[model samples]
Target: MRMPTRILLGCDFSSAPTKRKNIVVAVGARQAEDAVRLSALHRFSSLDDWSAWLAAQSAWVGGFDLPFGLPRELVETLHWPGQWAALMAHYGQLERSEIRRQFSGFCASRPAGGKFAHRATDGPAGSSPSMKWVNPPVAWMLHAGVPRLLAIGAHFPAHQPIPERTPPRIALEAYPGLLARQLIGRTSYKSDEAGRQTIERRQAREQMLTALLEGRTELGLKLDIDTAQANALVEDGSGDALDAVLCLVQAAWALRHQDTPGPGYGLPPDIDPVEGWILCAKRP
Candidate 1:
């Protein structure tokens, strides 16, 4: 039997989206077992706009570049609700300042080199600790992003039950850095600061894009993009578009494994419900 095509989305999210650094979503679909075709790229200048856009989508399987859940150790230590849904609800009510205060206190109590608690997926995925509020500010990403997902009632495999609806809107936590590092190994490929956007970063972006086009990654997927799309990804300098496409590739991998025997969407069978796993991230 032929399977229907599913729209795949890869979001490079921003906690405080603005006209300058808007959220970027790469829209695409799997063309074959080893290839994905980029159809469009959408940008939203505000969190409300992005949330509304996501809510309006009929169906899709997306890999979003945001932490879906906080670390279990952090949650337990803070005595927040241990359940994922309840925890998210509690977290949504707290102001960002309070969150920072608490997380800061938690860090102050811990020893050097281990200030932040980590999720199991963080190590293998090479993701920042969900509790970190600076540098990448993923904690803010979770604050701004997850509530919107819950508001739209998107299905998160293992963490949230699949809806009974005919066409499901699925979301998976994804980190483009994981795939980028696999291809370029710690070479910086992007910088939001214009002064830091050097030719070397552009070269690095090109290198990763070439690897994706050649199907050289372990995910066994190739990216089919036009010259314009390729050039845009490399020239943007922020790498938001490229990161979204990288996430799109991961979403494609998850879609291919959506019917696997253990935990659909290529997630680990033992994935923590309170601390969700990243799609296609290797188990440690």
Candidate 2:
């Protein structure tokens, strides 16, 4: 059994995951000289299955495409538990409908454009607000993700105020969009809409794969994938697969900095645990 020295996982999360809208994961292993191999791709039909896989991996450091925290302003306004631990516990007890209702009410009380309170990390990561319950529904992703990490006793770097520890497994918030923009600058490479999956998107994936393999991005790591795997990655125009790879790259980037001060995987100095920063996201 080859226990990987470093595991890079890119998670394309879905709050209401089904067979069609399954959680997409790209798993990679770090080799010598910061080279990574796309070892596997996984899909989860439900959250229980995903949680089990996470629990079984007792030795890995990875990145997940889910917000780790909610906005401080929203927490305060709703009078939910203020601290991270208490807040997560409180949140874990709520069903989806309640979450939608609470989040919708919060938006209703505010003016348009300012309906959702922003996390400091949202600007840099280009992520949907953690409080948003519709559209991308990132709020639900946080709801589904954070508690599982806590249950599995995984370490969350920059996910909270508690000092980061090098545990059996470590997890960090990741946003593939950040890495994609860095590579393809304003070029659209993926789409869920079948009609929107064009040759241009495939070409963009080709460029992205080339950049990753050549060590051109901020990850400072090279990817080792054969021609067949490369074809699979490029052909999946849903972008879920590529997004997972981007997140994996981000994980690799953060792991290199895990031993530094705060051991936060290159997370910024001013990160708020209640509104955590995305690993390697560029601040505006």
Candidate 3:
């Protein structure tokens, strides 16, 4: 029997609807060569618009760069109902500014250095708090991204809302760093911001691709790159090639558990199933 082609998606997410810092969705399919081949790249104006698109996923394996839940500590401290449904209900009642104020107050009450106590998995996963406003502000991404996934009844770890008559939607919380670190060992990649670009960084990217194709990383996924693709991943400053690779890792993970408990595509063992994963550097 022929295997069904897996539709794969990678997202560079932002919570707010703005001209800058908007969310980018990269769609592709896993080729017989075991590489993720591009289909389309979309930029959405708002979470609602993005959700509308996600509602169409019947054959997709998605990797989103957003945290799925608030820290248990944060949720409990705020006294805003612990269950996912109740918490979302309460959160939905408040405005964005109000939510920011509450979180800011919580930080103010804590010691300077210990202001934010994150989950054990957060550091390794390279994710920002769903509430953090600065430096990879992922809180907004969750607010913007999760609800859409929920509305579409996408299968995620913490928020499992079932959409009636919808096709099976498989979405994963992905961390791009998981695969990047495996190949590059915590080095920087192409930055969209112009101020951070450098020649040495460009060289590092090439070395990273070579290492990935040579299977030198700890990840079990082997890269199949020809001369042109390798150059695209390494020399092109867009980072599109690497992002697609991240989607491939997510696809591999999803395929492994497509028929098992929680559909085998749930968060990793170390991750709190409630908190979910932001699928970064994954091993196939």
Top candidate on TM-score is: 1
Instruction: Name the TM-score of candidate 3.
Output: 0.79
Clashing pairs in 2: none
Model 1: residue 118 alpha-carbon error in angstroms: 0.5
Better model by lDDT, 1 or 2?
Answer: 1
lDDT digits (tens) for residues 84-201 of candidate 1: 9999999999999999999999999999999999999988998899999999899999999999988896878858654454245788899999999889999999999999999999
* Residue lDDT tens for model 2, 55-136: 8875777888988888999999889987777888999889989988888898899987899999988887787888887788
Residue 82 in candidate 2, Cα distance off native in Å? 1.4
Question: Candidate 2's error at 276, in angstroms?
Answer: 1.1
Runs in model 2 deviating more than 4 A are: 1-6, 161-165
Per-prediction TM-score: 0.96, 0.92, 0.79
Give per-model CA RMSD.
2.0, 2.4, 4.2
Better of 1 and 3 by lDDT: 1
Kindly give the stretch of ten consecutive residues in candidate 1 with the minimal lDDT sum. Answer: 160-169
Enumerate residue pairs that collide in model 1: none
Ten contiguous residues minimizing lDDT sum, candidate 2: 157-166
How high is the CA lDDT of each candidate model?
A: 0.90, 0.82, 0.64
| TM-score-superior candidate, 1 or 3 | 1
